[model samples]
Target: MQHFICTGGCDGESSTPGVCQAEDCKKEGEALTPCNCEDGLHGEVVEKKDEDED
Candidate 1:
């Protein structure tokens, strides 16, 4: 699967290509780029909680 991301390094991501929403990128009408990673795995950090920690 592929996803779209902001060309200007914004947080805009979607399943389909679309214009960026960042103020700076929006000003230049930046478009999203096709993500070339596995299911858009951009090194995101996930925090798992222990069932007994809470």
Candidate 2:
């Protein structure tokens, strides 16, 4: 799964790898709508493999 760092200061999926020590870091490692974290910063796009494709 991939994630992007949110620079909006809000809360969303964390793109940062490993555990984010940031208190405000809203790490979301799932298949859900991404939320702005701080501003300008966008979460990484996670690619999923379809069973049919596999």
Candidate 3:
């Protein structure tokens, strides 16, 4: 499983972060394919590993 990230502003870090669909979003409606497309304030390659794997 995977999720998008915002390396600029969000840094993929938020209390409720995943994919920002807001107007301030770097890559609105962007999918996590061909990853690392720096969309404004975003970079979609941050992987959140599963706890099960740890």
Candidate 4:
């Protein structure tokens, strides 16, 4: 699964990548990053290998 998350120290996340909606992020205009890792487990995008890819 894939999703978007905010890196501006806020809890903002969306199905599509976009600006963070947190009050603080509104000022900084933080952009959401696409990732597949567990929430907060990674600051950068993480991709999981599909078993079928082997």
Ranking by TM-score: 4, 1, 3, 2
TM-score of 4: 0.55
Model 1 stretches with alpha carbons more than 4 Å out: 26-28, 39-54
- Residue 37, model 4: Cα distance from true site in angstroms: 1.7
- Total clashing pairs for each candidate: 0, 14, 0, 0
Question: Candidate 4 regions off by >4 Å?
Answer: 38-54
For model 4, what is the alpha-carbon lDDT of residue 2? 72
Model 2: per-residue Cα lDDT over 4-48, one tens digit each? 443323334455544334454343333334444344334343334
For candidate 1, write residues 1-54 as lDDT tens digits: 677776444557778977777776532466666775674554432124335422
> Against the hidden reference, what TM-scores do the models get?
0.52, 0.20, 0.25, 0.55
Lowest summed lDDT window (length 10), candidate 3: 7-16
Candidate 2: regions farther than 4 A off? 1-17, 28-54
In angstroms, what RMSD does candidate 3 have relative to the true structure? 12.4
The prediction achieving the highest lDDT against the true structure is 4
Where does candidate 3 stray beyond 4 Å? 6-20, 33-54
Residue-by-residue lDDT tens digits, candidate 4, 1-54: 578876555656777868776775532476788778665665465334345522
